[model samples]
Target chain A: MAEPNRSKDRLALSALGLFAERGFVGTSIRDIAKATGLSISNIYHHFGNKEGLLLAILKTASERLLHELQEASNQPGTPIERFKRLVQTHLQLSRGLRKEAKIFFLDEEHLSPEGYRANLKYQREILDLYREHLLALQEAGEVNFKSPTIAAFNILGVVNWHLRWYRPEGQMSFEETSREVTEFILHGISRVREP
Target chain B: MAEPNRSKDRLALSALGLFAERGFVGTSIRDIAKATGLSISNIYHHFGNKEGLLLAILKTASERLLHELQEASNQPGTPIERFKRLVQTHLQLSRGLRKEAKIFFLDEEHLSPEGYRANLKYQREILDLYREHLLALQEAGEVNFKSPTIAAFNILGVVNWHLRWYRPEGQMSFEETSREVTEFILHGISRVREP
Candidate 1:
């Protein structure tokens, strides 16, 4: 059972790397097999097809992300504290699961109808998680925003777009960059107001 | 000359629509030819091949976007006012060029090396333009942020991600949504501090 689970995990990671590099449309089962050194039949036995492999990868990634988010949500703090933890967790997870996150965006259009629905459901839950925290902050008078939905979208956008331009080897370490992002998201570019 | 230019513009628009729908990899020159009702050679006459057509479309779109940004940058206003105009300009232009914007993000990886470099240069300039405004605001003591570069990325992320979820037929009109985003970027989720 352990051997089987390890092989499946390896296959999923290998597929994710290929999908990220070549895209779902550009990657083929043969390519995945070549990358993993697994027989074509063995790959099929595991995932059924390319779409199956993608669906597995996406499902796993979403579940893991949601689990981390749940942990962040349960942390004891003010809304700002929880929000800070959420932002840090989100960025850290995103950096850690860089390839999986890339697949969630890039090859999303290729998901089968069933896969699409499942993926969208997870995505909505994630968005709703953000909105819940935001609404709590609003109620506590710690934050004011017009629409929780749109505000949530903006927050998610700030973090998600990191996958596009962030370079860990650049000027700032990921820790420093994540801290700056958390500050920007919390306070924005406006001058500090007198307390 | 007008007739040729019109034909070329029509071809680019057609290609953009197809690319957005089918993606650059899934889309074929034959599909483009069929969609545009042009023979293969005629399509070739306009753009050497599918890659050339995509390159042409991307180049034209970037140039037009930069031109609009330049106009917004030239507007008379304080940095915040100008930033508002820039945000409005970006959202409006993004709405107007929805297909182009979609193509810019979706099919960008397929660009040839030369095309990739050129596209990246234009994108960098756009980011740099945002940073300049942000830096000015920082200098004037209007805004307090650690890194102008990261702040600019956050601003752009908020708007660009609009292309993913923004719907013209949704609850808020483009004007209203753009206003909300501008406000969010200017100030963030924090409550207004008392002077």
Candidate 2:
């Protein structure tokens, strides 16, 4: 990356780190500067203020997360397969972008009014993607649900909460967690006995 | 209730609201006092400081949630009935004590180290209650799982995240949302024929 790009990346990454550790209101410009090894004034060269840094980080992560989802959905597969792909991609992203993902979940609310609205617009669109896929699966008789909104929330809540307790070196790898959680969310723990 | 009891209830409720909106670091003694129409000195008479107020809320809410769970679990009936009672009671408590619950969920880290550990002790007790119940269901062959944690996560996450989007007056009452979410979680959307 070029000089400005490198600085922005540093700012975004540092912002992510600090924001994740100590929420948005808790993080200071000095803290971000210290994390990035830049002078506070120099930090301003890349992002205007604390809120500016937050907006940049959220915009970058939001776009990246959406891109990952789009790529997964475009792959050839069964509806179930596509759903699995979505869960796997999300789990992988959550691991790779641990700090950024944490900040995204925790601090996006700190954005200025306009930025907050835009960020939520993107968030709702991503949620809508899940809703659409779920509705399709329901109509195909793959699942039983009357409300896509409830379905989407059920799926997202189960998958996204992995950030809180999912450990990379724990007994289960991220992939295993993804597979098991995905199946659990899509299919319950019960099985019918063979006649 | 006596005046003193009502006064304490108002104090705890006000503490929860400030803690939720401003967070632990952002809130001040004066802020809590202002919210409750008392001087900071008067507030101090009840609890030593912000930490005391927070500690009281956490202790009180934890006891409230588990007590409700115990009541539900003891209600007259079978395993399914017991589970439904647990779900309904949990959902009701989650709605009524949302601010305190959110503090437990998102703001526990802000507590003093001792407070944090103490809070965890209570939380672990409640989580164990849910897990042990699930274990009983599984041992009876009522539940089957490749990963028990995932199943538990789905059940709790669906209920926990209810605060995020559940409206006071939607097409579904809190009771209906509770029943609907629990039913979907317990059985999932997958049909037996499809499986």
Over B62-153, each residue of candidate 2 has an lDDT whose tens digit, in order, gives: 99889879877877786656766776778788888888877787666667789989898987777677776666666656454556665666
DockQ of each: 0.49, 0.43
TM-score per candidate, in order? Answer: 0.93, 0.89
By lDDT, the best candidate is 1
lDDT of 1 by residue, B1-195 (tens): 547567677778788898887788888878877887876776678787778888888888889998999898778988778877887788788888888877787766777888788878988988998888888877777464678888888888888887788888888877777776777787842334667
Tens-place lDDT per residue, model 1, A84-120, is 7888889989998898888887776667789889888
Q: For model 2, what is the C-alpha lDDT against the true structure?
A: 0.73
Deviation in angstroms for A44 in model 1?
Answer: 2.5
Off by over 4 Å in 2: A188-195, B1-9, B169-172, B189-195
Stretches > 4 Å off in candidate 1: A188-195, B5-7, B188-195
TM-score of chain B of each: 0.91, 0.84
How many residue pairs in model 1 have overlapping backbones?
0
lDDT of 2 by residue, A60-160 (tens): 87888889898988698887778778777877777787887676666554567887797778768778888877766776664656677877776677766
What is the RMSD of candidate 2? 3.0
